[model samples]
Target: MSDSHVTPPPPSPSAGRRRAGTTAALIRAQDTAIPQADRAGSGEPPTPAQAFDALHAYCAPALIRQAYLLTGRHDRARDAVVRAFRLAWQRWPEVAHDRDPAGWVRAATYDCALSPWHRLRLRDRHPDPPSDPADRALQRALLRLPPSYRRTLVLYDGVGLDLPETAAETEASTPATANRLMHAREAVAACLPELADPAALHRGLLRLGSAERSPAPGSRDIRTAGERSIRAWTRCALALTVTVAGATALTLETAPTHYLAPVSPGHAVQGLPVPGSLGPLSRDALKLSTKLRKEAGGGPERLVPQAR
Candidate 1:
């Protein structure tokens, strides 16, 4: 909503780099800070749109880097962030009211980026290796970890989250998460002996992230996409509801107002005009009619019954 609270990342890669997960202005602007004007009187809360804008501006850049670490592919990382924010915007009520809006978005981004489903995509199948040999080695090691283990390692080590926090975010018990983190470290150590220390592994992960440029979509772009998605879904639901209602109304209009007793079938009488039309003749009736016609119309054989 205002530029004072929303400071963007340093423009150029050459400008200066901080450790991963450092957003320049986020520390001061934490938890959707209220403006002086709002805080002065009435204690009015910022509108949903205002709150969403503030949250996105605060979280997006750092999240982009984290997503890059989660998925090595730049495009996939970008898509995951955009998709996550789009979802966050759509579910703004739940996200805005949550204790940690940033964490909610982070979890969504991680889930999207870490999904095994991305591996099936044709273009993303090939690996994009970093130019630096050490970075390349680390990337290979990270990829080798199982999705669960990989996620746990990134959360606990790379993002500076505690064991319980990582466990909660990954939806795993703390003990299981600890096991995953331990196994992940061992696996990475097997690849590169220098990363044996947890601190060194953390630095390695950050270096790997910084080496690759994360292509996170703009906050405005994500918000617009979310709004467009909501509009499409709303229109679809409305159209379906209208169609059902119209069908019901049409059925009601054409239906009978009252009941009438059903009538039985009728038979034909010779030389007498029936008041109403008779039902269609059966095969035997038609044949008998043909035989009677071949003889006299009023013959005694036709009138009298024969004893078998």
Candidate 2:
């Protein structure tokens, strides 16, 4: 990996053209999040950083809220959004060209927030309940529901995504999404009878989602961290490649060049020392030779002496 800093390239012309049709006001974004100096040249498409800033500014809050509804926790919700944007910045070109950039980020956020691993954390094992009694009950109901069902309900009802869109985002068929939504609504309504009506349930979800607000991350930091993450992974891959190449070289250096025939097992040979046996004593060698001469033409046991 090179030590040189690399700037993210500008979006393609097609992506830039989308910005012409989009206005910050359309998304109800509060801040440009980009400094005046970072502004693009007149009539040119916004830079990657600028586009990311605009997207982050617009979608983060809504995604966080939706995440809170999905996970029923503030910290997890915030973390999910931050991680999603970091991933978006890492794959800036894909995200920039995506038909629904917010949806792309939203999918990533939901996956992060709903990961089963988070449930294992001591911090996340138990979260503080909302202050309002109704909100508290609603969140508990949402938490009681299964993860897939909870996600479906939140995306469909809380985020107002149509059935087909929800199904696509959740990667389930439309029928399956509808089934989960139905089950989830039934479960929530079972806990809170007053929310039996769909409109009332939607309002309940909105109240629960809006009960808490986690701060949105700065786009600049997210981009920097994304780049840093890429650099770190690149370094790790380089180090692993170098290690593998070094190991291969070492093996080649020590390996035998030609095959040697194997010694047959269980074969006996005369005058060969036993494995791990020491050399014969000097006095014993002479005595053994004399004994052998005297014992010639005798029993086989007398022809050879024990090595010891």
Q: Model-by-model lDDT, in order?
A: 0.77, 0.79
Off by over 4 Å in 1: 1-27, 30-45, 248-308
Residue range 113-144, candidate 2, lDDT tens digits: 99989967988978668899999999899989
> Once superposed on the true structure, which residue ranges of model 2 sit more than 4 Å away at CA?
1-31, 34-41, 264-308
lDDT of 2 at 151: 89
lDDT of 1 by residue, 1-308 (tens): 23233332112222123323443354455444545665567767677766776777777777888877777888888888888999999999899778688889999999999887887898776667789999999988988888899898887778777766777999987667777777788899998999888768878888888866755466678788889999999999999999999999999999889998789789866897658878999999999888877765445475766679
Highest TM-score: give the candidate number.
2
